[model samples]
Target chain A: MRADARDNRARIMTAADDVFGRSPSASTDDVARLAGVGIATVFRHFPTKTELLEAVLTLRLERLRERARELSGDAEPGKAFFEFFTQVVSESASKLAIAEALTAAGAVAGAEAQEAGRGMRSAFNDLLTAAQRAGAVRTDAEFPEVYALLIGASRGATAAKLDPAVRDRMLTLIYAGLKPYA
Target chain B: MRADARDNRARIMTAADDVFGRSPSASTDDVARLAGVGIATVFRHFPTKTELLEAVLTLRLERLRERARELSGDAEPGKAFFEFFTQVVSESASKLAIAEALTAAGAVAGAEAQEAGRGMRSAFNDLLTAAQRAGAVRTDAEFPEVYALLIGASRGATAAKLDPAVRDRMLTLIYAGLKPYA
Candidate 1:
């Protein structure tokens, strides 16, 4: 793709992610308007609404994967792991909405999106390993447990529509649990 | 109600709880057989499948409420609180199934069941207060947070179809988080 075309595609992705994430029923025209691109350009990049959603989901997963990779190297391993954990939980509500929309539309997550998710999980494992090794987290903690906790915590917070302050306390308690013996 | 009639009703509820919880689509006849009662007895107690489910949900909630009340007097408040929390989560999968079955049948939890739920929540709050007072949980942990955690963790475990061992570890991590700082 040409540089301008790549830029337009990136812009379209950013807008679609934000738009569809917040309002799953948002239109491709909304994406076009948000991206400051023509409808033609939006369709050129994503032939269908489902395709656009798939692309957005893939981008979101890849973004988390990249963020996890970056955080894995932080000097404060525990903080890095947990901050990433919190970020993931906080973002999960919107991400879930997007996934649900896709499902409702009878579109399963495509292969590339699943691949990105696996990549994110792999990166997430690196953060978990570092935190455990640093003696910051409980040594017995493993990826599956952590992953389940994340899913649970995110779902819990979202379902309750918990106030941000209360959610933080909830997250704090979880962090306390994740830490090494006091 | 007469003693035998009350006994029959109780028996029907127990059987329905088990049957529909395990297989949401199980027939009323299955419940009758499980209760060792005649089909007429089951229908006499619960006129419809939805009625049976609602009754079971109320019974389940009341059972939890009673359990919480009993555990509140335990010598070890923390142990009681965490144990109840674990029990609720463990049973939530089945309870949720019943609830979903009710929803699928286009029946909402009846007012009595809703009352039982509130009563259970109140009892749960007492347990939380006792645990916090006993220094079993953090001082700042409020009912909403605990409730949200319970919800999140339960949904998470169920969604992942986590192995029993992994679910325990996840619960352990959550328990650790809820503990008062060392």
Candidate 2:
């Protein structure tokens, strides 16, 4: 692609991210206006709205994977795991609207997004294994359940009238739950 | 209300519950037809989709409250609390689509629902207090945090591909977290 075309593509993606972050149902025209590009230009690069959404999610998921890799080498596995889980919760909440929109559009029906989800899950499993090996977390529980709990809590936080302090409390409880028995 | 009119209303609510249980966005006409009532009669009774949703949730919430009350009187406060929490989680998952629809339509924002939510919170608080007093749960954590964590776990269960056994294990971990320090 030409430099100018690449720039337009990047600009459209960034705008779509912003617009869909706010209103998941934002139209292609909204993305075009936000990107300061013509509708035809927007359609030229991305044939369909679903394609645009998938691209945006792909970008976000890539960033999330990068962050997970950075956290993987942290000194304390338990702390690293907790911090990574917290970050995932916060970041996932931010992108949840867009994910919902993409799912609704039937764009995420295949293994493309599934592979990304699996990558994140594997990162979490590694953290869990490290923590259990260190005797910091209980051995009885598995990774998927822990991840599911964290994800659920994140979504509840979005809906409930909770204080920031409450989130910390929730983290403490989760940490406590993960502690090994005497 | 007339006897036949009351019967029609009950039938409509039951049918709405069944359809919405399957698909939250089931059309009013579908519900009316399922109830063997004319669309005009359904409209006459409900006036709006939101009204119909509220009617269904109102019935469900009443049943939820009754269950809470029954659990409160059970032999083991801790066991009862866990059972009650599990029931809430299961119901929430099963009716999530309808709940979302009700929330979107602003039916759940009514004063009645708010009061009911507060009542449920208080009921959970009472259960937590009883369990703590019985030395079955931790005294350090607040009741609201416990409720929030359970809600979060339920939300997580909705998204994750968790097996029933894995879910049970996760709940066990949460219950362990709620226990007093050994």
Candidate 3:
């Protein structure tokens, strides 16, 4: 796609994401309105509602993947893990909406999306392993359990509109649990 | 209320709870069928769907209050708090559904329901204070944050259908975070 065309598509997707974030049942017209584009332009870019949603999800996931990559190189693995987890929870509303859309549409064939999720999981496991090795995290800490819990908590944060202070406290508690027992 | 009438009311409420657990939107007839009571009898007792739901929630909250009371006496404060938190999370679907119903109907003014919620909160606060005094839980820990996080996690668990192992692991992480650094 040409640069202008690509930019238009990106604009449309971003607008659609914002609209859908507020109202999951937003119409293509709503997206077009938000993008200051015509409905025809939206259809030209995304053939169906599902496609439009998928595009929005793809954009968000890409951002998350970039964040994971950035965290992977942090100076301290424990800090990286904590920061990444916090970031994920904070932005979970968009991610969760996308996940819900994907599940509902049964559109699990997006290899790129799958890879993005896998990359996140891989980065988490790496951080966890490093933290344990450094004696920062608990010896009995299991990667899958921790990841699942984080995901669960993140999902919860999306719905409950949890206060930032509460979230910080919860994170602190989890970190304490991960600490090596004296 | 007479003893037999009270027993019958208890039986009907228990039966309604079971039916609602199976299906929150279950019909009044279904509740009556499960309770081994006539539909008219159920109607006579509850009067409205909202009333029935409130009754069921009151029962659940009452049981939780009882559990909190029992734990407060026999267990260490930290352990009791943790156990109560876990129990709430484990049964959050029922509690949350009822809470939502009560909030929606605006029928949460009954003395019994209010007392149950207040009693549980006081019990939880007592446990928290004791744990803090013992230097087990963090001094910075606040009751509202803990409650919010637990409620948030419980909501997430319901949405995600989180497995028991994953839930326990998350709780462990949370407990770790809640513990004092020293």
Off by over 4 Å in 3: A1-5, A23-29, A40-51, A93-119, B1-12, B22-33, B36-51, B93-119
In Å, residue A111's CA in model 2 sits off its true spot by 4.3
Clashes of 2: 1
Residues B69-153, model 2: lDDT tens digits: 7778878988888887777666556656433532332334555655555566677777778878888888988965786686666
Worst 10 residues of 2 chain B by lDDT: B98-107
- Local error of candidate 1 at residue B134 (angstroms): 2.1
| Stretches of model 1 off by over 4 angstroms after superposition | A1-54, A93-110, B1-54, B93-110
Docking class of 3: acceptable
Model 3 lDDT per residue over B1-182, tens place: 88976776877888888888667888989888888888887887889987887777767777777887787775477777788788887775444464343232223446666666667677778777877887778888788666656655675555445677776776777777788875
Judged by TM-score, which candidate is best?
A: 2
lDDT of 3 at B42: 82
Q: Pull out the clashing pairs in model 1.
A: A152-B152, A156-B152, A177-B176, A177-B177
Which has the greatest DockQ?
A: 2
- Sort by TM-score, best first: what order? 2, 3, 1
Clashes per candidate (backbone, < 3 Å)? 4, 1, 7
Restricting to chain A, the TM-score for each candidate equals: 0.87, 0.83, 0.84
Question: Could you arrange the candidates by lDDT from highest to lowest?
Answer: 1, 2, 3
TM-score of every candidate:
0.76, 0.86, 0.77
Q: What does candidate 2's lDDT look like per residue over A92-150, in tens digits?
A: 45555533532232334345555665565677788888878778788877876776676
